[model samples]
Target: MQRIVLFLLTNLAIMLVLSVTLSILMSVFGIDRQGLGGLLMLAFVFGFGGAFISLLMSKWMAKRSVGAYVIEQPQNNTEKWLLDTVKRYSDKAGIGMPEVALYQSPDMNAFATGANKNNALVAVSTGLLENMSQTEAEAVIGHEISHVANGDMVTLTLVQGVMNTFVIFLARLIAGVIDNATRGNNNQGGGLGGIAYFAVVFVLEMILGVLASIVVAWFSRKREFRADIGALEKLKHSQESQLEGSMMAFGINNKSKFISLFASHPPLDVRIKALRDSQ
Candidate 1:
């Protein structure tokens, strides 16, 4: 519940900031009052539009960038078993059967993505398959499935799209205002004016972006807790092993490769602790 609240609040704040900043920017650009609604609609189109497009293209992006091999229908006995396991979990989670794929990454990681629950993909790294025990692998897969079941990827994309619009709005607005203030001036303004204005806006946006990222990261950490809970609940019906150890095992095994910024998931210590305390 705390995680859900944090997720909603953070996204709300991002949307609010983006809307207000865009309105301010539009005003500074001398946009007609009558066209404000249209402009806002355009903003929404660009924001949500971009996000949904990216979501749609996620499979292609992953395949291209990471060289993911989609195991289409998993034909052989071993492949069939893997597919069956995924199917079982998807059924247990009450979500559609997600397409399972493999990617060759040295890092022991797995991620799930799609625009919606029915249309989803789950990809596991070679390291994850090779290193983790069967129980541990199932637990980690549970965590990734939880991410899909919880619709986290879509939510994050929405939040990010809103942030993007705000960044664009603020940077342009600040630039326009400063440019206007410096207009009709010679050495006092013109030559250095545009550059100076841009510099200030850039700095301010960067600062805001950094702070926003921290907030986003905090929200992300909360969601990890919820996903852990989901994993535990799934395990109750499906398996007998403790979910807490799975995260610890993952961390202990791959601590060297886990980079915080690139990793949307929280640290394993935090996840393990949260699961233990919750149980």
Candidate 2:
């Protein structure tokens, strides 16, 4: 729940900042606000721009948020094994070697994030290493590698860009109409009617953003299944059963319906069934 709130609030801040910046630029340039073309241009500028910026900053943010320490010089056997395992998988997956790291988390979770496939960071939790057997831990690593190999982060960013474009475009378009109706020919801005317009746009953006996330989450679930399949294939002929069981265990133990609608991965049961069915 804290993560969800943080993510939402961060996105809200980005959108608000970009909107205000663009508004200022438009005023300076004397851009006409009477056309769909101008609105769309502005939307794309801020929408895709913000998505790409976030993508580029993802690795740095992940490290800070989780206190992930990259294994520059492996100090222990486990760190050595982690670096070796990731290198082996990256070779098979046909991607450049990714920086491997460990974070201090009690939860059995891991993630991969970067701007591109060749440049990525894969990090796992301390809990995952201590709790899971060697085979299970390797499977988890393979899953994260698959995410990088499949370019899931880049694709997700593009999808978000498109969604952001539409959300901004629609919110402002509706807000303009409301403003015009309320003012009814008054050209002055910053009146009570202008305040109403701003309030309406803010509320509408939040509502539309929520709706857009459903689509993003749907795509995310599909990718999770694909990544599972990729992991199985990558680890084929080696501890297949252990990998499957480990993934299922991780999912089942961490199941929650509260954020299902906004979850990046599908429910554990669904993922387990998909893995079993695929075999």
Candidate 3:
């Protein structure tokens, strides 16, 4: 929960900073957000700028928020086994060994995050280590390692940038129109007070942002399925069984489309079916 909140706050802060900065820079260059080209350019910068910054800072923020500590020296069999397994899988995946860490969490969860495929951080919850069998943990680590090798972080950043672009563009476009209409002007003029205009844009951004999040999450789910396949390939042989026993539902995917839009991963049953169908 803390991790999720911190990650979101970081992204939001970046978005806010970039949005304001882009507006100022564009204004200095005589670029009007009302103009189609200017609007697109502003959107592009804000969208991609915020996303890339978030990517660059992902590992740092994840470590702090999750209270994860990298295993510099294995103190016991569990830590040693964890470190060795991660190395083995990362080697097989053709990526550099990621920093393996553990966070004190009760949930059986783990994640892989980094800006580069060759350099990454893979962290698992304490509960996962305490409860899962060796094969299950191996499957879990392979899944995360595959995420690093597949460069899902960068891919997700691109997807987010595109989504953010649309969100920014559509919000500003509609808000500009409304502002003009309210002022009884044909041109894109701010009839609303300065505060009101900004407020409108803010509201529009929030609304469109939710829609954009759904789209991004849909893309993420697809990406997750791909990582699952990557894990299957790298772990071959008993990969299907490995995943079946290891993969757990990370979100409420069966609720509805709207709910599923916010899911971190597809349901375990769906994933299992996907695995079988693939082979």
Candidate 4:
């Protein structure tokens, strides 16, 4: 229910923002409003549809790549603890139950991905289990669960697809309109107008796409903080100091050189600082 609300609100915000920007750009450049509107409509459909499809397939892709083992919903006592913890946190965060999987990977990393919060998958590397204690593992699990609850993966895919569709449609739409408007008035405008239009749209899209990606990345970073806070709260309520210690244990990964770039979770130092400062 919460995920549905956030999804609708976020998409509404994106459409509103795009509409305002497009209107301003069209007015300033004397561009055709109808053409721009059509282009945007096309983009919205393809972008959102493509992203949703990708989300649906993400589980299969991850399982194939990482060789995930989907446990049969926690039969024994130990499994019950893991299952119950996920359930408690998922309920508190207002998301659905996720298919929890353990994967084999040397790197200490974990991630959550899915089409929706309910139909999600959270996976952890074997390295994480081998090195970190149960408390740390729970903290990691809480963090992964937070990603699904917050809809970070779905949101990122939506934004990326939207940008891709805009870039592909806008350039062609603008070029077609320009070619039609200036039929035979100026040979130079007719001859080079398409090229110029394409160039402008391409460059503008690239720059804007980079800026947009940064915005998405910033959102991702912010969510990491939220998830950490969630984890801390969950642990604290359970009367366990394991959350902090688990984070610290995982943070002690100086040997892994490229961990920063590959890791979706924020740096250990940042997590430590935030956790400490939260007190």
Show how many residue pairs clash in every candidate, following the order shown.
Answer: 0, 0, 0, 1
Q: Please, what is the whole-model Cα lDDT of each candidate in the order they appear?
A: 0.60, 0.73, 0.70, 0.58
Question: lDDT tens string, model 4, 95-182?
Answer: 8888877666555556677788889987666666565566766777877787787777777777667665765466556656655676
Model 4 alpha-carbon miss at residue 159, Å: 3.9
Q: Candidate 3 lDDT, tens digit per residue, 242-264? A: 01100121211122333456655
TM-score, each model?
0.67, 0.84, 0.82, 0.60
Candidates 1 and 2, the one with greater lDDT: 2
TM-score of 3: 0.82
Instruction: Estimate the TM-score for candidate 4.
Output: 0.60
- For 1-279, candidate 2 gives per-residue lDDT tens digits of 455566668868866777677667767866644567877888888888878997898888777776789999999999999999999999999999999988776656677889989999998777677766677778888888988998988999899899989988898888887666655346665423545656677788888888887787678777787445433332232321111111222221234556567666776567766888898
Tens digits of per-residue lDDT for model 1, 18-81: 5466556666876633354555555666566656776787756655555678898776765676
Error of 3 at 113 (Å): 0.5
Can you rank all candidates by lDDT, best first? 2, 3, 1, 4
lDDT of 4 at 227: 40
Instruction: Score candidate 1 by lDDT.
Output: 0.60
For model 4, what is the C-alpha lDDT against the true structure?
0.58
For lDDT, the strongest prediction is 2
